[model samples]
Target: MNSMQNYLADTVKSIPPSGIRRFFDLVTQTKGVISLGVGEPDFVTPWHIREACFYALEKGYTMYTSNSGLLELREEIANYMKKKIGVEYSPQREILITIGVSEAVDLALRALLNPGDEVLVPEPSFVSYAPGTVLAYGKAVSVPTYFEDEYRLKPEVLEKYITPRSKILILAYPNNPTGGIMEKEDLEKLRDLIIKNDLIVISDEIYAELTYNGGHVSIASLPGMRDRTIVLNGFSKAYAMTGWRIGYACGHPDIIAAMTKIHQYTIMCAPIMSQMAAIEALRHGESEMRRMVDDYNNRRKIILSGFKEIGLDCFEPKGAFYAFPSIKISGMSSEEFCEKLLMEEKVAVVPGNAFGANGEGHIRCCYAASIKNIEIAIERMGNFLARHRKG
Candidate 1:
């Protein structure tokens, strides 16, 4: 048998690979490419947080903790949520510490879905949810979000896509790529639909600290919804600790228990040192997060204003570092825009179509990049738009 088409699980073969990684690979191959493609924070992990990991190692905390994770880290995660998000979860039963938000998403989806069940996924979201849904033997029902509504999820939008087979709703806010956020009022609009239809929500709030307009509101915090929402957040975005790979999922005891089983078998636990560092990060990383948020906000303004100046209609991103600007003037598809930008300007931005079909006609730029690069990209974008001026 040819190794070129050796045996592979259908689940692995069925899923499309991440578009972000594709662009990342392309950017890596070409020299002098300044990437605005990556969604990760450019900041280094805080010194104290880094120090905690070293201390943990020194103390020989290299061994695994409990199967779920360290009690201390889970307790800290509980306290962090209670203090900041106005929600409380018991560290023992309600939370399962995970490798990262990525792992939490994977495990949560796998735990909740059965064959042919459907999950309603909001589009222009992070790349993982839809594929993960399919991998769980479920259908991913993508609901197109509108820039006109600021990408908010209204109940009518839900109603149109709802069917008897629908089981879970994967919601990401302070969303990746598009940066859409749903305030309390916006979330309340979906409360009845979610309740009446009995849909479970996997709320991914990885960028909770970066909200510019108002406080981040969890749908789980809304009335009667806490029991059904599996809230996922982590130390990665807030503490600039993506490499640490520590995240937690808090939800119904049944779901948490199911996830813990998967964790026990496949991963055992998150790294011991990372768990130690995660506790300290929750306790002390707030000020560092604030500074990062303020800097990102400044960069956000520069990019959004530049988009307007270049005549692209961009939804005002409320939370995450990405700005998804509509590429109306370039007379090009999102992929075309991105490829041309990288080749001609040596500046790399992710194509919107990579996120979903709903992302066509747009491109996502991460304001987490340096101000100098942001300015240069903006200047180059202006020149790029000028070449294909519609009027």
Candidate 2:
């Protein structure tokens, strides 16, 4: 008989599973593991937001929302975007609620690609970008950014990767894994390049609310770029609502309409209760959001200082809750370092190679963990490093 595996599509079989999930699964089976592998916030979703969901259920709002999502939530999202980032979008035509930034990204890729297209992706980025590009029948061209440059994707680096086939540039400043942010001046350099290349952009700003230094900047707000940028954001990081699984895409109406068409057929809509809860999150949960960001900032300090004390070279993460530290002193590859550390000390952090090949020789430690856990993990890591250095 023919094998069932042989029946699967070649494209589906070719995609590799997420690298983060390997360490996570190991931690779940091991006892007393202190994990910094995942990027989820340690905080519970705010009570008032939960209460909004409960109230929606009480009012029997369990039916599917309109394929475009609740108008109320979209309006609130529009207002929030304007106040927070100085970007204006029409709630009716330019906003589409999605199943978190994950689906938003997928939809954007699907809407824009027409097979054999090229997407410029900055590395040491989140795991999904390259795979998502491939799934949408596009090629992902990796643009390397180094630790010496603080992991910022320079305009020159971006220019080298562009060709006639290049269609999109995926940007995730306040980036995952590295936690590096692009300043307005840094983005200004790209504005000319993007215009010169006639490229569209997919800007993932999921960590917008957690930025330090100056506030987060959306490239879509830059002059002459709004029509060519798709901004993907969600409530997962800022509102600690990962389980709610609601997000949105904002761009020109034509793109939004195209994304909405796919979302309608595939997702129908995001959960109705989540939409109701999101409205409350955008409208009344501002103070609570700020409180969480404040708490994360405090924990961020502890993690950065602790890494310094451990004698590891760590870049100061200006946004997001991750600390990417070099493990080159131990003479191990990023995967080897992470695996040995986990086995020796039961402290779990993802290897930098999980993000991209350019991330070798470093490890990603997520600080979206409790302060006590962060302290203990750091201590364990220090001990692990000491042993490895001696060996």
Best model number under TM-score? 2
Record all residue pairs in model 2 with backbone atoms less than 3 Å apart, i.e. clashing.
none
- Write model 1 residue lDDT over 1-391, tens digit each, in one string: 5585457887888888888998899899999887889887889998999999899889988897898899988888888888777888989999999999999999998898899999998888889889988888999999988898889887888799999999999889998888889988989999999999999999999999889998898899988999999999988887889898988899989999999998889999899999999888888888888998999999999999988888888988999899998886777888888888888878889999889999999999998988988898898888877886566
For every candidate in turn, the CA RMSD to the true structure comes to 1.2, 1.0
Per-residue CA lDDT of model 2 for 58-147, tens digit only, reads: 999999988889999999999999998899999999999999999999999999999999999999999999999999999999999988
Q: Which residue ranges in model 1 land beyond 4 Å of their true spot?
A: 1-3
- lDDT measured at residue 274 in model 2 versus the true structure, 0 to 100: 96
Residue 225's lDDT in candidate 2: 94
What C-alpha lDDT do the candidate models reach, one value each? 0.89, 0.93
Q: How many Å off is the CA of 294 in candidate 2?
A: 0.8
- Per-candidate TM-score against the hidden true structure: 0.97, 0.98
The model with the greatest lDDT is: 2
